[model samples]
Target: MCATHKAFFSYVWRKFLNMYRFSVISSFLALSCFLSLASYELPDHSNGEPTTDYSINEYWLSLFSGFSKDVDVFYVYPTSWYKLDPAEPDFCAIDHPTMLSRSKVVFDIQATAFETVGNLYAPYYRQADAAYTLSLPADKRWAVVDSIPAKDVIAAFDYYIKHYNKGKPYILVGHSQGAQVLMLLLKNYMPEHTGTYARMVCAYVIGYPVTAEFMSSNKHLKFAESAEDTGVIVSYNTQSPSVAPGANIVLGDEIGLVINPINWKRDETPATAEESLGSYMPIDAQGNPALIPHFADARINMAKGVIECSSVNETDMFNLSGKMGPEVYHSFDIPFYYYNLRENAQVRVNRFLAK
Candidate 1:
């Protein structure tokens, strides 16, 4: 899995750095450990207000500041079913209550994977897990949380709309399990909030799918069909034609929803595309990078179109299975994924804000 993620990284490094220096540096054990340091500290969000409790670590916020625009992006990360001991300093412990925080006016919900005890990473379970977190706070802790109820998700969104959302235009972003939650958010909330959707620049959902059902339901919610600017949905997923043994297999949401970041289209072929990094590269009509965004291309299809995890979509069968888990290979993959998704985000969001 690490190697697979690294391949995606190679593509990204090729696109931006001009040389694979980062990859070379990344190979060094000590340097890699230092890079692994949390890019951002979870903001201190002990407060109870929905908007106030959401905060981005300084490192993350610093990175976000590089954006050409001031559009606010709310990020929801996956969580494990670990308990938070307010007694502990890592207030951002894996639990319900500890997940809530007051960092910005935006609302950031943390997906709770901490409490559920099972061989997770299954298809339907991921959907259910993501749905559960979409409505919870960054710090709200729960005991023995239920893991199979989609209805809970609907109710949670209702509560969020009444409380947190209250009618504000916002950008949505997520990865992996969190991405699953974002998918449901678009289907259940975004479309219905067309007024808000219009106000929303776009959704940056990576490592997940934006299925046909979702695309067909909302005329406004289209995938990034081209490298050119787009609105509403900017989605993609990474897949390796063959992952190493013992890799983590993520199942949920069909492959249709899982798109190739490079093309922003359905996953169909392993096109041999090359990325160049140099002084003069083509820029999009919108002034964004015209070259393929780094790390945007993936080897697997994440947005397969299956509503139920157990459904008959062959894409659902695809997994990162093997001896080691996804964690081993995620570092390389995550940056590239973020690089591509953010590049598209920069374009679509600027356009959305301009409108």
Candidate 2:
């Protein structure tokens, strides 16, 4: 297994600080711990209505949702609920300041890759805390997944359809826990709503699993066989071959559906560092991102069902998988191939519109 969600001071600060440097993002982590605690202390976060209701504008974090783009992007942020208390509820409130701050930073970094290709709309959802979910065995974690986060996200998606979509084609984007939520939505929601499914450009389910078993059972869902494939799912977890040896956090028992962000191929063929279009990395201590060329080389680990990029540095990804055993590059999945994803999204959107 990969590293436990280790409780280290430098780990959280260094990981988040190094990742963003608070450059383009606001002061993300400085108040996160305190703010999360404050959110827990609040007596009434829901205000009579179920806070999960997306009809209320407070539940959305719209970045480019109204941008004049032809396509729309409906994004769900990853697990930002880091107030690690076992006594705390399994899911954090939508108003948890830490989760909201973290969600903003991640939306800027991860979802913005699609901004050039579509108008972006991210919803605030009640996601599980990292430590609580990570503590459970992999198979059992879905119990948490099937509960709050799933409900909030699907409700938000339903809201997006009835209110904002206006018949525009849209792309589904989510990472880590956010990606897991999208998986649930795709499996349970999309099937019944064929009209909405038809308008879906594709899903960028990064840093999570879209396992073979998942695809086999849902005959309507398909994994990305190429960069330009529309109405398909694009997913892969990032890992290093040298790091941990046991089962990873995201890919449970089955083989995950993967595509090389560098080359868009699922097979184990290596995509050299030179083939990369440069990664978004912090240029200095301040965390301003720069397009650093040749940041990583990607190749699929078929047995492990992950994209192994040995070229990545532990400091860059904040060594998120440090406690597990080896490297699980969960944090760097999107940034490592930042430019590639930005371009690939446009490619798929363009292809879909042309048809």
Which residue pairs clash in candidate 2? 2-324, 3-323, 3-324, 21-287, 243-326, 243-327, 244-326
Residue 199 shift from truth in candidate 1, angstroms: 1.3
lDDT tens digits, residue span 212-301, model 2: 888988999989999899999999988888744455645645468789999999899999888999887655444546677887889998
For each candidate in turn, the TM-score is 0.46, 0.84
Best by lDDT: 2
- TM-score: model 1 vs. ground truth: 0.46
The best candidate by TM-score is: 2
- Over 1-355, each residue of candidate 1 has an lDDT whose tens digit, in order, gives 2456445534443444332122211222222222322333433333331321112232121123232334444554433222222223322222233222221111111111111111111111112222222223322211102222222333443443454444544566555544556666666676566575665555666544455665786665677655555455655534343433323233321344544444455445432233311111212222123223332233433333311111111221121111122222221223433334445555565565566
After superposition, candidate 2 runs with Cα above 4 Å error:
1-51, 63-67, 244-247, 315-320
- How many clashes does the backbone of model 1 have? 60
